[model samples]
Target: MTTAYYVHVTIDQGKNVMLLDSGCTQSAFPLKEFQKLLFQFGTQKISHQFIIADIDNAILLRLDFFENHHCLLDFQNAQLKIRDSAVRCCDSQGNLLKVNVQVRQDTVLPPRTERFSMARLSTKWVQGTACIEPADTVPGVLVATTVQDPDKQQVHLRLMNYTDREIRIPAGKIVAMCLAANLTRPAPTESASHGQLPEHLKTLVEESCQGFSPEEKPKVQALITEHQNAFSSSQYDFSKTNVIKHGIPLVPGAKPLKQRPYRHGTAQEAEIEKQGQSLIREGHGA
Candidate 1:
């Protein structure tokens, strides 16, 4: 079954009417309506702003005072009201320009239910002469689970991490991960041939590698190796060194190398050559 409702809107000034579907977020009427209303009522503008709320009971938008306008909405016998002061408008455009509108609804939500499931195991033994009877199944550990009730119309979320690790994901990081997973097209197979990293990861790596030195490449490599070994051995503890607190740096000299023009030679060797040339040019050494 479809889950939506329609709202009928009317502008009392021009006697104009409109039908708004459930999906409609905003609505507006022609300017002439406000001009006619103001002329007839002899009022500069209508007071009381209006708010539009969705079926889920979320405020969508608010319309301020209506200038050169009369009543903004006639809810077709619905019990909606505008509690705020009226919107204002300048004298320009004959005060009849189209005025934007929003729909507000008042409703209550129902309660949700929870459910649970289990996994089981069984065991049996056999002797050389006779087979032993099967043992009764034993119950495993119990886990809590919650899901949105189909009958309930609301946003719900459930998170389960078996390891019991405390992972605090930053809002920006979560957004980046979501975008990365939803790329429209597959990345090129020969990305390395182009000598460029993916835009997003490249940005992350660049930001991470900034201010690193050629001499520090070994240190960065060691850090990465340490993390890899610790993780592989199941000895890594995020609570001890969180990414936000102890960030991972990129390959050594990556930042400075990126800032300078691409050199055909090895990056590490090129950096050394550039430094040597600068020193020689400055009459410091050969």
Candidate 2:
């Protein structure tokens, strides 16, 4: 938001207001008002000329005695003080049309003045697109078995770090979770109603499976098993390479939750957690 104030000026015996906006980069007068004033004053003659920002223009009339003449302008309530200033008129193609003498006002005031403290005007222009969805139902992560439609079945995974450290989850890890969840076939001993991964994702899962190291195969397999049981289970936890863990559920609409009080189970646990948290705050450890 930005604001600018202009003083009164008379054209053709009628009052018109002029606002100087440097952002415009050109002098402009209201075309309709200018025409009306010209008709009323019946003056095509030029009175004075001056330069404004290196452009020359003519000032045919001055309206300094606005109050005495009973002429009203757009910013009638504007308090004005006169100083030396000038303006120039230009055409659409940037050609210099004419110059006009303008009176400048010292808008700056002393620090203690009440007018300086109290006088203010503001204007705001909102400038953005709205993409916000209902807070209650936004998904934090997508799972392979989770249906894509908002009205259908969806899995909301909550993640947290209660260990007094910052954790980074690599993109590869998330991709692996998706692939593993899609690849696992139902055991013969399990029920037949459990859904299988779509055929389109089989090739992707196979390719991703080949990229896992020997040590990672067990973890991937475990994640698949846990995901299958996640709906019925109370909670799940998994560690990441960056010392952070995932699979914790975020409370719905819980962003405004306040910080929990520090719990000290024992003196030793309290000291260790305190020191660890301080180090994490200092960026020394995850």
Candidate 3:
């Protein structure tokens, strides 16, 4: 009989939250969220080899080395400067259809306008199609990106004016929703059954362990020996204890103390009492 062990890990990269799935043959990420990491994907060949689709039909991409990684989100697009202008359309007889390009007075343009806003994305694959939408319910339109030219960071976006009123897109507005089609493939495996780790991965794990320092090797071995039961056993018992009842002890002779009235305080008190007696003789206590 073989005992299978699985562990769950929560990965948070800025606003992105992902989980470590053991049943999943490979790891996966949302394209929009993936772009926010300080990591880059490897060439498609290496990626395609390791990142196959899981049973759920989601394609899993593995992370390459973590060095000199770059984020793909467009922080500059948080606030875009919208300038107002007029576009004149003339009829055959030079009759102009004048529509003022309405710009909101509160709208502020960025200092530089020669270059349009662009969005960068990251992926291990050479090229693939993705669906881009607006994050919020707004009039901002996506100019769109080509699935053919998803170079390292060449994905650019253009905003189209859909509404008649020229308005300002406030800063920090999340306006891009990009999603890639589900890449489906078989999970990496050596045999049909699921209890064993992939052969390639087993080799890599062995190599990694072999490369550990001499002092660290014993620590790793100790951890494995200590947690051997966790890997070999499938049953876990969590018997609840009578926590509240057993927490504090009841003392038999406990009693509440009573307050006492003021008595002898000082010589000043005795002198005051004598003065009070004299005053009472005179029919006055003050």
Candidate 4:
């Protein structure tokens, strides 16, 4: 039989110890343990209801685990922050705008910094939404969009202020939380070049692309659409394109150097060259 080695990670918030299984396909925590820690340290929303289910189509009953929660754990000089709050947008004054955030079930929370990464706590994908609630207390709702980074490992949230007055968001208080909404299985994605479509067009593409073949036709069409959206080249149309095409204009003091004959250098020159070679070998040459 093969030997199994496991690493234990401690979560200081609830004094919970989690097992890190390298051989396992996905990370997970016991339901009882999850509930215990969540109750002790996590914030729950009594107004919101969340339903968690299992792969066998059985509803894994859970207590109210809706409101945003943050539990920070430090490991090896890296911070592993756990929370349901995926999007946190603030202004220069540290004020967050109350806005509705809709994201895919597989959306991972954005990292705090380059050094930080999301801890593999569970394999289960959870979908959620912080629905648009009446914000009469605040001036107005801020419009926001969630953007994923080029690497696809990171995501960014950009919020635009719409109201005249500034809204002050208090520390540790969530203006809106990313709530669990739905669970989805992995499926073939659209054209790789065009990742996620704009919200308005996304719906249209989804509805229309359903009938189109995912392999060949859609990919070609998406390529065509992207090329069509590109900016038109002005050089071909501008009359001044050929006016300065041949050669660049020279500055007043700029003169081309004439080739100099190679000559034997003096002792000082040889010493300087030796020092230069030493510097280059030392990896400090410019």
Candidate 5:
């Protein structure tokens, strides 16, 4: 079991403890008395909705609160900081834009966990105007495609931790970017913009002697049609690939030696077994 950490806080003049959870979206106190829990927050003049929880601690602090208030937690030095918000936007072509996303609070993700957590989105577009897709920029993390709420600027990021160790995502780190798709498509570049889908696809093979087999051409076309949004103009970016494997090389030697297999823990063994069964089901394994 993982250990828990607590911080001393005062609620309604009563000294109490609150669990600091980075993975939590909202912070709540157990008791009914909901006075302003004073602490070092930012200058945004923020107000949080109070909710009730049955936990022993006076408050169950979450990540969103810190992000909204622009508060930074320095775990190494035991320091809490409040800073003015700094949002970023790198490129914007027509209605297609890329905006920065930051974790609002300090949190540690356990291994093999997946959840949609709210984070600070740095964009000026109003709701319903844009859709969110993964930018495939961050490494060692998985970002799922999520649409921005049309009525609000809020964005919930689907984060998945693939490693077996805890991942410490500190506040203000550019963990991911939202690929915003809004009205008014970006101006097309290259042959795809001017011609119809079939014509543009023909251009790819117009000059080549090679041709797709009649039996397989339809299937290939269907796959592209299903994800047409991913292929705009000619610059194609489908998304990131997620797979874990390592290749071992043998050295040239006069003597031969046999080696034992590497061992994995219970969790890893179960996962390997599951994947092996999957490969077999997919006819990749006998």
Candidate 6:
């Protein structure tokens, strides 16, 4: 897919969408698209294809290459067909309705700061839709797959800018096929699940106020429900942000020792990431 407008990025592009930029052209990939393509076909690697500027194209379908390779392109109708019988799966992809994610505010995603925002889409839906993973679609940014609001049709996106410079996303620009797929109805909120208190909250209340009188149970439950966010789920959670931090102090002029990063394979990496993410998600860590 190719975006209509050109983007200028500061840092080197990510691994998935590598580009070999020269002249006025560059090759880009994965995309601002729902349907993505990753090929790297053909055992022959050209002397070119370096890590280059990421533009709006996933496939660089140059006219000269088709002419040189004796392959024909239907330029008039704008279609390409491979006659090889081995290539069977290409034709199986059916029609798709690409959804456009529009921003409410002109978002400026700074490289070092985390950005989280809500924006509505063109199509209104009763359920959440997953983001298409904006790879090189909008240059250095990637919009995370998140649940959308059913009523407002609002989408929560965690915008990450891998580039050095800030990426300015205007209020009404659509990056090519920036698409989304509708997901199943999101899980009910706390009030929707039960009457008021969720199962966990009820359990917490029962466990904490077991010794309280029957007359005070309702009041206690109400108090706990109102302050539920301050409640910790486990030993690891310490998220009462207003509370003054208390930690053991070191003597004056004591230099903190540098700790080596924990090394584990992909499994540990994923777990560590999840741990860090959960902190941010729950508003425990900034």
Candidate-wise lDDT, in order = 0.29, 0.32, 0.36, 0.32, 0.55, 0.49
Clashes of each: 14, 7, 1, 5, 2, 0
Q: Which candidate's TM-score is highest?
A: 5
List TM-score per model, in order: 0.16, 0.16, 0.22, 0.20, 0.32, 0.31
Spell out the clash pairs found in candidate 3: 81-109
Best lDDT among the predictions, by candidate number: 5
Model 2: how far is 154 from its true place, Å? 62
TM accuracy, model 2: 0.16
> What is the per-residue lDDT of model 6 for residues 36-112, given as tens digits with 9 covering 90 to 100?
23332222222223222244443343333234333333322222322331110111121113345666779898884
- Which digits, one per residue and each the tens of the lDDT, describe model 5 over residues 11-96? 44554454556787877867765544554222223356556667763466678667776666544222345465421212212121
User: Which run of 10 residues does model 6 get worst, by summed lDDT?
Assistant: 85-94
Off by over 4 Å in 4: 1-138, 145-155, 179-286
Per-residue lDDT of model 2, residues 172-279, tens digit only: 122101100112344532421344433343454466578798888656644443345333221122223632345676888778658987666798797898888876
Better of 1 and 4 by lDDT: 4
Cα lDDT over the full model 5: 0.55
Q: Name the regions of candidate 1 deviating beyond 4 angstroms.
A: 1-28, 31-33, 36-286
- Residue-wise lDDT of candidate 4 within 174-200, one digit each (tens)? 223222222333452353245544333
